[model samples]
Target: MIAHVLDIFFPPLCELCREVLREGHSLCGDCAANLKRIESPFCQKCGEPFDGQIESHFSCPNCSTIELAFDFARSPLQAAGPARELIHALKYRSRFYLADEFAPFFMELLEQDERLSDLPQNTLVVPVPLHWWRQQIRQGNQANEIAKSFCQSSGLPFLPALQRIRRTETQTRLTRKQRLSNLHNAFRIREKMREKLTGATVILIDDVFTTGSTAHECARLLKKKASVERVIVLTLLRG
Candidate 1:
């Protein structure tokens, strides 16, 4: 009741549509419904949507040789339009409330994507981390906020299994090679916690899967340090 009164005074609005809403809602219903899901016949490796169904497991011709160590990857929403706007709001607007509003969309993909459906009920959720300095400036890391909220809602374990050892420029502004080079030696497994990760099947969580370099590097370190069986990457956006 008090919350509702506050909402009446302040007027909650959807980040995507700017429509006024009742208390406890972020994105309006229609805007939420309009979010696009990634369709089938996409790249097996990078999760890039293709025109039609193709036969190869290795669908990414460009990065196939690089070999994403993860078992599979998926971005529930294609990064464009409302999807793009929502992500920017979360990343720049510093409104983690959006992720709490937006997480169900990511979780809904589990029903459509077989890989996500098969994730073990007890799986560990690990969000890709930003360097401590960047996190301070940003107030919070977007991926960590999403993963933490998801864990709380789903009753899954949230793990800070990886760390950004060095600061790097934003991947958005860098070329593919530059992104890779910049991220190299940028991550390290928490030393004492290595044993805990040995047999763990990890769901590597992030906000977006742009070039996949960051997720790739994180997976690489997890593979090398922990001898983990599989590292699956999950992101909100596939571009």
Candidate 2:
């Protein structure tokens, strides 16, 4: 076949290292192994990594008194090293195909994490929306792309139920309090989309979880405005 011959002439290479892939793989095994994964002993509320032994359902001291809208948060990889490179490629460089590589890995993480096993069966996968102006500049929403790929692989439906109503300042240098204030009232569910969210569980998708200001605001809107029963946040990387 023409496709078979083309493969012989131009084999697929790793996205990061350009090493030849070993059949049906995008990233070479070595590069894949180099990705830093987020494991156990993390905060129950915010999913921050902890250094010492902690009992199940334990909240990190940082989040102990902080009230979050989502039931829990999780990420597959730490936001560093190869994971950071892949995120940057997908987010800033417009390497959209990298989403295909992230979808399965995220699913694997979801399955392995006991914290997520109890998610309501009526869950919907929703990506945090970008402001319309920001979306125009980016040419694409990486979070939606990742959510779409994840839904395709998992047979769960993807919902663009939430909209970013305000265009705020860049959150890069903002303190946690400032980030929260900046994102407050920044999200609203479309009127038509509101009905679909009633009594449904939500899995908010994003590329990274930093201070969680964005996720919190989105979840708050979904819960208070949409009457959603529960919200759980999931991202590719935890900062």
Candidate 3:
């Protein structure tokens, strides 16, 4: 076939370093190994990584005051190194294939975490939604792609239950308060999907976690409108 012929003439390169891959994949093992992973001694509520030896399950200074709406959130890697590169490639560069490479890190975290491993059987996986305009501009939603890939691998049900009702300014430079205000009432549960969320544990999915304002807004809407029992956020990177 033409595809096979192209492979023979120019074998697929690793997406990160452009090294010729023995097989086609987003990352070579070496680049994957170099990604900076988040370790323990993190806040029990927000999953913010901390330094030095500390007691486990304690709230970090920020979470102690801020009070996240979700029960907890976690990511396998920090938003740096190859992790950042992969996220940028997938989100901004239209490399849809990277979702396959990014999802296992989330699945592995779910498998390894004692709390996340024992979620209620009624847990629902929901991706952070993109506004219609943004989705049209981007040509696809990277978060949905990553969430669907994670759901497939983890045997969880994937739902496009949340919709962004308003377009908000980018949160990159926004203060925490500004980000919260910007996203207020921005997300709503789809009417048909509302009935399914009653008393269900919700696992909100996104590509990255920065101030967590977006996740918090989604969780608030889920709890207020759908009466979701619990909310746990899982993102590929903690920014």
Candidate 4:
């Protein structure tokens, strides 16, 4: 009754198109339909979509020369249009409810991946952590919220095993080399979570995968410090 009254005063509208929506939905059918899912012919190592026709699995040129700590990284949507807007709203505008809206997509993506669908007993979902200063400024971590939503829906264990020891500048304008250098020694394994990570298959969660410097650094810390068996980087969008 309260919800119905609230809906009457402030009707639910799609986040992207402002279309009227039924209760309990952040996006309307049209906006949801407009989302671009990443298709085949993508790099197997980094999940970067390819423009040309390639029948077999392959790695992108970026991944070819680089040594990544994670086994693979995958994202459901291309970071553009409505997908990018939604992420920006969630991360910068503090529209945190969008995390729940993204959870189902993450779950579906995980189910489709053979490597992720069948999890071992030692598997855990870990969000790429924000530094204490950032967390205080933001009041919450977007990655942590998305990871928690995913874990709640998928029945996976959520483990915040990594911490940002160094708060570096944003990577938006940085060159690939600058990104790599900026994130050097940026992460560390949480001491309390050290024992839980031994031989664990960690699903590292984040909002976006740009040059993958952040993911690689976090995965490296997990493997080197905690003896984690594998790291699979998962994000909502591929930038």
Candidate 5:
């Protein structure tokens, strides 16, 4: 009853188009349709979508040449079009409400991945942490917000087990090597959560996977420092 009254006073508007919506959806039909999902022929290791035809699962050249800390990474959407806009809004524009909208997509990805669908009892969802300064400035961590919502819906345990001990420069224009260097020693396992990491499978949640430096660094820390059994990187998009 309260929700109905509130809706009458303030009709929900599509986050992208600003169109008044009759339902509780964050995006209108057209805008939602514009978001592109990552289909097959993608790199099995990094989830980078391939343009050509490939029947069997394969790793991209990038993954083959390098060692990654995580077991595998996957994303349901391509980081373009409406998907990019929504991510920017949540991370940059402080539109925290969009996190709930992203939860369903995470659930979809989990359901589709056979490995992730049947998670072990020791599995936990951990969001990639932002540096203290960035967290203070942003007033929230977008990854954390999304992870919380996903945990609520999926009945998974949420563990903020990592902390950004160093504040690194933005990796927007950096080379892959440079990005990795910048993130070196940037993360550490939280003292209180160290016990939880022993032989655990961590589902590292993040908003985007660009060059994968961030995810790799975090996974390395979890595996090396805390003896985490496995790390599966899950992001909203594969940038």
Candidate 6:
């Protein structure tokens, strides 16, 4: 009654299609029915999904040669269609609530990977840091916002475990090499937080994992500075 009347006055639109979502769904039923998650047969080292073909078993073209610093990554969905728009809205449009909306989905998504079940205790969840200057311009760090919501819901402590020391423009059109170079030495462990990270495992959260250069660099610094034991990157999508 009253709730239905309110729906007439203030309907909630689907985050992806902008259609009216019926009651509790974020995506309209049709959209939800078709949205694809990253089902397995994925690369063990990099988390890229595959069809289990021989060709699909190869190391990702971008990361084949160099050793990846982090253990592995877990992404909730394929980075396309509705997932892309949803990520962009949260990353660029400042739609922060989706961070909370996506957290449980990420938790479930990660569970499908056998490695996630044995997560070591004292594992700290950290967001890839944004430069203070750009964070000022954007009014906030999206990763931090996501990490905050994820921690509140999951009971895992969120730590400001990484700091950005430089600002780079968007990485949208950059090559993987360019992305890697641009992020070089851009992050460091804060001195006060350094002591707490020794031998702790970490889960680095970000809105998307594209070339993974940014997360790689951050994890590299974490290992070098704080002696953290393991780093697992987690994101809503792998673009």
Candidate 4: stretches off by over 4 Å: none
TM-score of each: 0.91, 0.94, 0.96, 0.96, 0.95, 0.87
Which stretches of model 3 miss by more than 4 angstroms? none
What does the lDDT come to for candidate 2? 0.87
Of candidates 6 and 3, the better by lDDT: 3
lDDT, model 6: 0.80
In order, what lDDT does every prediction score? 0.82, 0.87, 0.88, 0.90, 0.91, 0.80
- What tens-digit string does per-residue lDDT give for candidate 3 at 77-187? 999877898898899887888998877788779878899878888998999999999999888999999999898888899988999999998888889989999999898
Expressed as tens digits, the lDDT of each residue in 1-239 for candidate 5 is 99789888988899988999976568777776677888788899999999978999899999999999999999989998789989999999888888988887878888887878789999999999999899989989999999999899899899999999998898999999999999999999999999999999999999999999999999999999999999999999888
Ranking by TM-score: 3, 4, 5, 2, 1, 6
Clashes in model 2: which pairs?
Answer: none
lDDT of 2 by residue, 1-239 (tens): 99779878998889878988875457877787788887778887888887777666688776776788888888888999889988998888888888888887778876898766666678899999999988888878999999999999887778999988899999999998899999888888988888889999899999999988898899999999999998889999999
- Could you give candidate 6's per-residue lDDT for residues 1-79 as a string of tens digits? 9977988898988777788876544666666556678876677667787776554444666567777788788787889
Runs in model 2 lying further than 4 Å from the true structure: 1-6
Show the colliding residue pairs in model 3: none
Clash counts per candidate, in order, are: 0, 0, 0, 0, 0, 0
Q: What overall lDDT, based on C-alpha atoms, would model 3 receive against the true structure?
A: 0.88
Q: Please give the range of 10 consecutive residues that has the lowest summed lDDT in model 2.
A: 21-30
Ranking by lDDT: 5, 4, 3, 2, 1, 6
**Candidate 1 C-alpha lDDT tens digits along 1-239:** 99769877879887767788754478888888788888877877788887765765556676676777687788888898988888888888798887887678767876777777776654788899999998898899999998988787766788897888898887788988789888999999887767778878888999889888988888888988888778888899888
